[model samples]
Target: MRSGYSELLGSMRPTSTNAVVAGEADPSEVIEVSVILRRANPIDVSRRRSVLTREQLTERHGAQDNDVQAVSAFAASNSLSVVKVSQGTRTIRLSGTVGQFANAFDTTIVNLDEQGAVSRALSGPIFIPEALNGVVVAVLGLDTRRVARSHVQLVQSQNVLSSFYATQIRDLYHFPPDLRGDRQTIAILEFGGGYQSADFATYFHQEGLGAQPSVEWVSVDGNMNVPGSVDDTEVALDVEVAGSVAPLADIVVYFAPWSELGWIHAISMAVMESPVLPTVVSVSWGWPETLWGDMAISAIDAALADAVALGITVCISSGDWGSNDGTSGQTTEYPASSPHALACGGTVLQSDGVNILDEVGWPGSGGGISAMFPPPPWQNFGYSGRAVPDVAANAVHYKIHFDGADAVVNGTSAVAPLYAGLIALCAESMLGSHGAGFLNFTIYEDFSAQSTFRDITAGSNGGYSAQPGYDLVTGWGSPNGAALLDVLETLSFAQVQLQLS
Candidate 1:
């Protein structure tokens, strides 16, 4: 009988159709690859509280020693040097010549140029020893095309969105003054881009944040923050938004190279049970699951699951191109598609000179059924496949300080940090010394109770229309801070489980 690998191999196009980088993957040339192994068993993070104690979170999951040894031994046998292993994320980094990779995996590697970008990818079937079938799940960095893109977009119209400020929005949502994310740590992920201290300073000074909230830069894969640059508008928006909303929370921005390798590493870094663990993680970059191969998807989804199990709140942007996901049409993006992440959507919100007037799902907000993921049981009432966005925030226009001046920005990119800030505040209220688990559990528990939702009844994102209750366009509607906190204050995971049971 043919192995399951046969099907995945069949899906890739042959090397003949793609362009090759000059002298790439030559017998003498060396390359780096990541080997991701499967967990021995599934982890259970469902708990009586929202987030768990660090000790409880760490004890729940990790790579089995046997799996790690098998992968390390495989690398040694193949003449690949073992660089590093993250037991927390179940990943091993290896470096070897192209010839060794080709011989070990039974596939030739090729470089391809498409659009304006060039990438390295495998030309044929990626085979592994039959013994490693269940132990090893994926081999990444074989195709650099799996890199992710930032989801932020710039609004063409000026001044329309400048009137809105993060603090004001927080007030509009009725975020309790006592729960302003004090001492909470929020981690933001970036594939490639950086933020400037000066820009952050400008934003905070204007916002009158007596003293700036502390911010730290954590580099992954050796990519450091590129401060004061004209590029990377996405990074700037994230910093400004998070700073404005959760001014008291410490910000940890994870920067990495612009490939799938970097993306996974960045995510793993945020969720790792470090001395300073983050209460919430914000991801503003992603592409549809269709673009990410099974190897990449499996690894990413697994990492996200680990984060969720650890009681870390993972907030991801649901893309900016409406239902199309910037492709043919009606597709969804991942990390957002992963069951563990709280996928945030976008809305065109109107603020009366002082307060919010009307809010509708942004025409460009990404929301639809996932092509690769089955919708989580909590969301089965609305759709079959996993939905793009579980919640939404204003992405139409926002006042942001980037490249010196205050300009208007848009995209669901703004929504993740928006949700992250709220989570930090909520986590501060609930977890205290502990960290957070998935916020979606609480969100879905109250789906019927209807605490803290605006119920957007108008607007549409191409194929789907926003309706009463849960709809693809604006999942569970926008946040109503007071009602949400009220629901959160009295609820516990134990209570939710009891109610469900």
Candidate 2:
């Protein structure tokens, strides 16, 4: 429909420039762009009443001989099975359909006494079962019995250097060892509590890492504030490990109010609007994906896209429960399952004090192909299923001296932030040269090159097992920091050569 001269002018315009002339026909290249529809809201109700209080239930039943017995009785009476009960918070986890449990207890248990509050019997939507081959529905709840016996101990141990591997990898990548003095940033996304300054000061002192890095808190959606002692363990792990790996990098903690929506919103907001826009974002808490709706998923996707666009990397913990997750069948947990983000699974670093024996995928490490998201473009080289744990780090029973706590409470929660800090080191080396947008791409490409990683060929997380090359377990295997850096540097050099050529 346009004349030759008009078409010529349209073709000559710069792709990045936006310009329009009066009475001029728009170029055909500007045809209508297809819009990806936003996902729907997952929450059916905005809010629900709290369930029966621990005190009221105890009063009504006359304190049982032991909390576990009471919990077992409660589960049996409700036709529900108890999976795991946390002794610290008295949180009881029940199995069965969330809706079915909620309906059954809504009148008899949830609404038992007038003074007792009952929280919603929501499903543990994220805990997918791999054993069911992905068919059964499972729900999770807090077991109040375990929570009542609150006792924490702090102990000194040696697995503290595990976080340094990421930094080592980055050093090998580039940034000239002397140039490492440049300032960098690491952002940690947390859902509960604040870190204990005394605890961190003690950790750094014990590790001989010098003064602790500067830490700041950004509250997202009115949930930001200091968390009580009970909830500070996870926060402390995130702060300490992240700081340890990237000692020079400033650490920013973004706190979200407790609740699925609050957590998602906080993460999204940080990804899109944080002042530093951190080189890496580390997340530790996540519910199953089914708990969220399309809207939440879309928001997460958009946030990830924005992070990539801004050259920021996001790392998430797959989950603590193995593939079966004991909740539902074997379904990958959300945020981790999200194709847009890099899911950091867990691994055990076995050593005889002086000599490191081997590293294998942790049986409790969360991984597997996503049931909801298709394989990402960068993940194309691996087996066809939902490949997970694009990467891994030491997670099992690593030793660290907590300032106020005794006992080495081991979980994948520690591994996520440790890796995040390491990634910061790598980003520092690149100095925004790679545009974080392509890190995942770089990982896959490097994996194919076979020079940057130690393929984890053994171990299994429930139904899925690790194999040579890429598998549903450890994606590209554990990072060979020095080798990985070399690959990254090589890729960087290649990019420069391409520009010159």
lDDT of each: 0.75, 0.53
Off by over 4 Å in 1: 1-24, 44-60, 156-162, 228-231, 432-436, 447-449, 493-501
Q: Residue 106 deviation, candidate 2, in Å?
A: 24
* Candidate 1: C-alpha lDDT: 0.75
Task: Provide the TM-score for each candidate, comma-separated.
Answer: 0.91, 0.65
Number of the predicted model whose lDDT against the real structure is largest: 1
RMSD of each: 3.4, 21.1
Q: Summarize candidate 2's per-residue lDDT along 389-439 as a digit string, tens digits.
A: 777766654334443753354566766676676566566676646423335
Candidate 1 per-residue lDDT over residues 372-424, each given as its tens digit: 87767666575668876788988866767876677777788988998898878
Candidate 2 has an lDDT of 0.53
In candidate 1, how many clashes are counted?
4
Name the runs in model 2 displaced over 4 angstroms. 1-181, 353-355, 381-385, 401-403, 432-438, 448-450
